[model samples]
Target: MSQNQSRVTEFILVGFPGLHREYYGLVSFVLFLVYAITVIANATVFFLFVTNRSLHKPMYYIILNVSVCDFLFSTTTLPKIISRYWFQSGSISFIGCFVQMCFVHYLGSVNSFIFSLMAFDRYCAICHPLRYITVLKSSTVHILSVTAWSIAIIVPLILAIRAYPLPYCASNIINHCYYDHIGITLLACTDRTLYSFPAFTSAMIILLLPLSFIVFSYCAILIAVSKVADSKNCVKSLSTCSTQLIIISLYYVPRCFVYLTSHVGIQFSTDVRVVIIMLYSLGPPMVNPLIYCLRTKDIRECLVKQFCISTGHPKAQVSVVTN
Candidate 1:
């Protein structure tokens, strides 16, 4: 390690640069609100999944995985930025920054894999209806979930291991809301491409591999749905997929745009880039629970049942169907 590395003990996170101090409170409040909502909503879903045995099927199992991922992702990224704005504390220890980067990328890769898992679950349910139950038994789902989460850790750990000892002697200012691979690597004194290219490659592989699977799965699903003779059944099948499709779009589209633009030489100002990044990163966590609650009948029914039970109206409880 270079002497400069020792000199830079902490990094300053310049969140949404050039904003006047007057708006700090407003930004902090909004960010805090988002963090609060994301935590509560995701926690509610996790609680429902845990407490209600009826929600233990493969699809809901995948949903449970998603809620857990969303919860972890938000917890990993939000609090520091909220503190940065609220308490005017943007300084993070070098080791803390690297740890944050590792978990941020790790959770993001896990999310990609989980979405692909969800797509695969839907594919099994709709395309292989006969084998769905046998193929995706609870034990099988647990195995797959463990596999996805376990495999997703490798690239991020590798990236962190490689990047952690870099000579970050030049600048200690991260021009983003939170620590991320690229932002932190760019601060290193060495040629950043040495670290960045591998990170980019890993990101693409992590993103596109599952994305390819998701696209193929959904297309096959559409074909299968088309073959169904009954209009009501077809409609029902598509309706069942609607929520995942919306979430998939929300998660992937903006990310693709950001990656594509950066790779192809299309440039965005730091503020614009950061804003876009924050929007895509934070937007999904905030909206995923809302989408599930409004769009998932079982979850809604469970919520209603819980609400009714809490309010001393057990008679008003809605029965949640076990799939």
Candidate 2:
């Protein structure tokens, strides 16, 4: 298998077989609901961050970026998948496959990196409140966010270019998964490590390294919150941080499993792969607004008011007893 042998024409994407069989209607309904809810939820965050002056601070600024990333990440794959399923065509062209893989990974990696930035922001805000204003300036947050996406895009682009020219004339079936380094390597005739090495390293950096930083930052935040003199302040800070922690854990766990635990050469069951894919892809966008609405008082009120008005229902006042 010469290096030149890797160059190929097109690839096939076997759309999730789990939904293709008996659960098509159910799966479609679930995805549609999730997609609608995710879009509205993330868009609300974006809108609030943009329109509200009170939300102009660094923390909500970072949250806005996270929302944007979640929206893009979900849109990269889920919509097209729904369309293909409805239209009864499971195949994606070679170019379509490559672009989808690139965008999905690019956005997913950016989301992870931005979450790290959020952790850092939370750390500074909670652990060093006095210096928070100066430490996490708007420019600094912007730089970090931009840098996160820039690196995410460049690394994937290089890897895609290097790995793409390979020949796939033997088998065109790319499976339904996106950004699968192992799957691509298994189908390739030449050395897989060249592509896998950079791809693996990038994944480790994007997934593990930022994850370590987030974990460390949260530890520091928890310690700092514990030392606060005001019990009310302590409770408030802990509540916010705990919510962030839960959301972070939810977002990171499935990703860590996919990137870290899954064997490189082995193939996973269709059901397992579909379930895992659905969980991570849908989790962030769906759960994010729920997190914000649950944890933040203002956003929750706004949502409730908006919902009450939309449905013409009585605005039920629920007391938030923060312990």
Candidate 3:
């Protein structure tokens, strides 16, 4: 610590610096609604997965992991920002900021890995039907899930550990809504490139590695689907993969654009950048449950059955068949 450098004990989060004061309530309300929807939808999916024995397969297990990650990520980030805008409270302790940063990146990375896992699962199912069952056994799925979560922790922790010791003698006001790696590190009173480059590289690796595998998996899946003589089976295979593809596009495309623009010197306004970040981060969690419910036959049937049972319509029956 330099003698001239003063330690920052807390940080102020500026939700949207350019926005007028009158819209604070509206912004806060919208954020609250997003939070509420994300929580309810993800919780419902998770509950269905837990209670329904029929959903106890490897594919649903992966979906269950994603549901847990989505809700957990939203929970980690949304409350503070909502409070910041709603209550005019934005101060967060320095340690608290770093803690939030850890989880934000941690969950994001976990989701990336989980998506790759989903792609792999789909690839096996579509490309090699004979070995799919043996390859993605219950124990294998458990090990992969645990490994994805465990490995995702390392990069963020290292970034946090590195950034925590930097001298934050400059401004404590973060320009964004929540604690994130670049948002906090840029405030340090030193050369940010040393930290920023590594952070950027790690982020790219976390994103691109899974993305590459997903592409490869899908390409192989497409080739396999082309060989199927039965058009119905081919369409069914494509339909199953389409849902995962929509989700992957939602998760990756915006993120890739953001990272690429930064790398290529194309800059967006702070508000625009923050809004884009919020959209990509919050959008997937909000819609993932809906996507699964509408697309997956088993989950949809289970949800409908549960709804009927809860409504005291035990004799009411529903069945969904997709081809």
| Candidate 1 residue spans exceeding 4 A from truth | 318-323
Minimum summed lDDT over a 10-residue window in model 2 is located at 314-323
**Residue 218 of model 1, lDDT score:** 100
Off by over 4 Å in 3: 1-7, 318-323
Query: Listing every candidate in turn, what is its Cα RMSD in Å to the true structure after a full C-alpha superposition?
Result: 1.7, 3.7, 1.7
Error of 2 at 266 (Å): 9.2
The TM-scores of all predictions, comma-separated, are: 0.97, 0.86, 0.97
Q: Write down the worst ten-residue block by lDDT for model 3.
A: 314-323
- Model 3's alpha-carbon lDDT is 0.93
Q: Enumerate residue pairs that collide in model 3.
A: none
Candidate 1 TM-score, C-alpha based:
0.97
Name the candidate, 1 or 2, with the larger lDDT value: 1
Worst 10 residues of 1 by lDDT: 314-323
Candidate 1 lDDT, 1-323, residue by residue in tens: 57668999999998999788999999999999999999999999998999888788888999888889999989999999999989999999988998999999999998999999999999999999999989989899899999999999999999999998888888899899989988988888888877788889989999999999999999999999999999999999999999999999999999999999999999999999999999999989989999998999888888888888889875576343322
Task: For candidate 2, write residues 138-162 as lDDT tens digits.
Answer: 8888888889878888866776677
